[model samples]
Target chain A: MSGEGDIKLLGMVVSPFVVRVRMALHMKGVSYEYIEQDLFNKSEILLRSNPVNKKVPVLIHGGKPISESLVIVQYADEVWSGKGASILPADPHERAVARFWAAYVDDKLFPAYIGIMKAATEEARAEKAKEALVGLASLEEAFTQSSKGKPFFAGDSVGYLDLAVGCNLFWLEAIRKMFGVTFFDVGKTPLLAAWAERFAGTEMAREVVPDADSAVVFAKKLQARFGSNTSAK
Target chain B: MSGEGDIKLLGMVVSPFVVRVRMALHMKGVSYEYIEQDLFNKSEILLRSNPVNKKVPVLIHGGKPISESLVIVQYADEVWSGKGASILPADPHERAVARFWAAYVDDKLFPAYIGIMKAATEEARAEKAKEALVGLASLEEAFTQSSKGKPFFAGDSVGYLDLAVGCNLFWLEAIRKMFGVTFFDVGKTPLLAAWAERFAGTEMAREVVPDADSAVVFAKKLQARFGSNTSAK
Candidate 1:
């Protein structure tokens, strides 16, 4: 029977959501073997584990597979509650607020970013880019309130919301480089701009998050395979 | 200085999602003021509480507002952990699995139902209906695995996934009545069909979920305003 020591993660390196799960594992100080699944030819285990989505970032613990990054992250927090700092806040209200913003990152910010890339026309891409900025601006307000001059969204340390949003920083930077659409615009959201810098400089962020160049290259490969609306400036 | 007694809920009676939040509150036996919002002219509290979405159902506790039904439900579970049966399972794996299915209901089944309602063409509506059946079939399989032959998705008592999916049972029944689209098909998904009957008959389900006739009435009102592809059978 598989046990806690037998934890494994199935993921592709470039996916930001996959990166988010990895961050949670890191925060929890849990050791797990990384099984990189080739997206072109998906593994049978990946399909079996997540028959619903067949997507990456499936965490197999004690022979049971848990799918979805946020779900898996929450699972890690629950299972390894005492191993490291809890990913979510101890207070119920605070935890709910954190969850709210984390969801905003997935359901709003990332979609806006993806919308820009997937839009069929430059005008549409520009429109999505504007939405992306608005998303960032909202998060900027959230950061000022939540962080209280702290560097991370979880206050002092990297937490769930931090991983949720911070995982996309490199991708946003890549978008900036490719589309000339800035994410960390200091004039508009100075606190968030600074938060991004501080978050990216964290040791785990350095070790785990893929660089902007890699994200750009991977994105280009994807665009080459499936066309994109905008190209590098 | 507001306290626990200051709980207030801002919601519209017609929304299934809003009912889901109320079910959570009911399950927890948390009494609060129900502030019915005329969505045409949203209240200042609703606007202030949920600046991001500006939608219901917003749960206000001690002057702090939390938006989104699922998020509010989780908050209720956490805050009232000591009271009533815990909404989510104590076991991490169980909790994760429950969350996954709950998300599926929102991200898959509900959308499919909504698609049937909102589709511009009959052809598109039929396609969405087929997808909805496929989603139900998948959930039937999930019910078999997760329930371990128990009645509830949480396995005996009503819990998170039960409420998440069950909140839509009345709406689904209403759809079936209006459009002749069967959800609780006996032959294909006997377990789920049986489970639905059992869940819907539960005291809370009877109390919290709007009756199918009411849902049909609400849906007709919506369609009269917004237009629908499929009319009453």
Candidate 2:
């Protein structure tokens, strides 16, 4: 129920968690002030907003800050329920299913992604990619069940599970572009591979998700900052 | 809205997560069939119910399985909203806060608690306890803000954040009785220390939470099974 310009989102360009919130805003047509944070330098408001974890994707609504990516997305869905189709499924069972996959993305898949970036060599990167794909392969049935023969996890519309996985795909795309490490390998996770291409092509994803090339540069810088071992081999 | 027999909770008495679901059911005035699972030899129902995780604390409602403690608890709240006080707050911001703390319990607090159990040496156990207290100290502010001059996080009643942390307290109590490792140190986190006592004394907690003595025995057995190094000290 927030008026236009009343909402402000604190985020970084490279963070998939940030992208998830931006996508939710776009889907709901809730226009807000997007404050880009210099994560390396940190920001006063960002820290103040999310004092607990001190991370980004903090949505300032009516002067109250909501942090954590999943919580913020759910908050947006609840507060702006009338504005757009619900972000989470209306049915409790369906909602639980969406949440299960979302947690899976955060817990297993994201760490594997971080593993690729922080891995010292190409082989290590490949190993991380393989790990991520196994996680994705596990979700193939989830995608099938949630989609119900439709194109999205919400069945004809992008919903929580879609956004959860979709936001991370941009990073995967950038990794593939730079390191040739494929996450949505067509031969392995065919459905997710197709879904990735389709989701990335969407207007909301195109605008909200960080550009693959830009993310590639950022990824390189990120790896370099960690150590030269990342550049080794 | 589920009838007495319609809800089936798959769980173990020793699991804090399972205890959470039981607490929710009692609060909501809902009755369910409790199926105690053999964690070592998982039942066929448990396997079929939660194919993804195949873990305990799976709530089967109307033949649909909902896995994950947080998810199951939230699902229970949503599905039985009219029965009792809401598990999550009515306000979106409040809900977000509760979710954030629940997640914190899962991510940080639980792991630290586990560290104490898995630690081989008494010194290592103390170190883990110190780390856990640091995490608890951070939550003192959260309790103050969420409680807002009320006794509970949901203001005058047990709610999401309360159950999230409260369920874990029994384990801590067991650890305290056996290992003398205190999580809610009165000098360190006075509010949490007091809250833990108050929470455990409640009727819902007493009935649902596993007995501390039994948990202590379980803990000893668990540590012993891990290795003899656990007993060396």
**C-alpha lDDT of all candidate models, in order:** 0.88, 0.85
Scoring model 1 with DockQ, what do you get? 0.92
Clashing pairs in 2: none
For candidate 2, lDDT tens digit of each residue in A175-215?
A: 77766776776787788778877888888987888777778
The parts of candidate 2 lying over 4 Å away from their true place are A1-5, A121-123, B1-5, B121-123, B228-233
Highest DockQ among the candidates is held by which one? 1
Stretches of model 1 off by over 4 angstroms after superposition: A1-3, B1-3
Model 1, A1-233: lDDT tens digits are: 12357898999888999999998988887888999998889999999999999999899997899998899999999998988779998889888989999988998999999887778888998899999999999999899878878888889998889999999998998888988888888899999898899989998899899889988898888888877655687
RMSD in Å for model 2: 2.1
Output the number of the lDDT-best candidate. Answer: 1
Query: Against the true structure, what is each candidate's TM-score?
Result: 0.97, 0.95
Quote the TM-score that chain A achieves in each candidate. Answer: 0.96, 0.93
DockQ of each: 0.92, 0.88
Per-residue CA lDDT of model 1 for B1-233, tens digit only, reads 12357899999887888989999988888888988998778888888999999999999998899987889999999998877678998899999998889888888999999888878877888898999999999999888878887888888888898888888888888888988889888999999899999988888877877778987887777777767654787
Which CAPRI tier for candidate 2?
high
Per-residue lDDT of model 2, residues B1-233, tens digit only: 45644788999989999999899888888988889998778899999998878898999888888899999889888888888768888998899999998999899999988888788677888888887887898889899899997888788888999999998887887777766776777787787777888898889987888887778777777766766333422
List the pairs of residues colliding in candidate 1. Answer: none
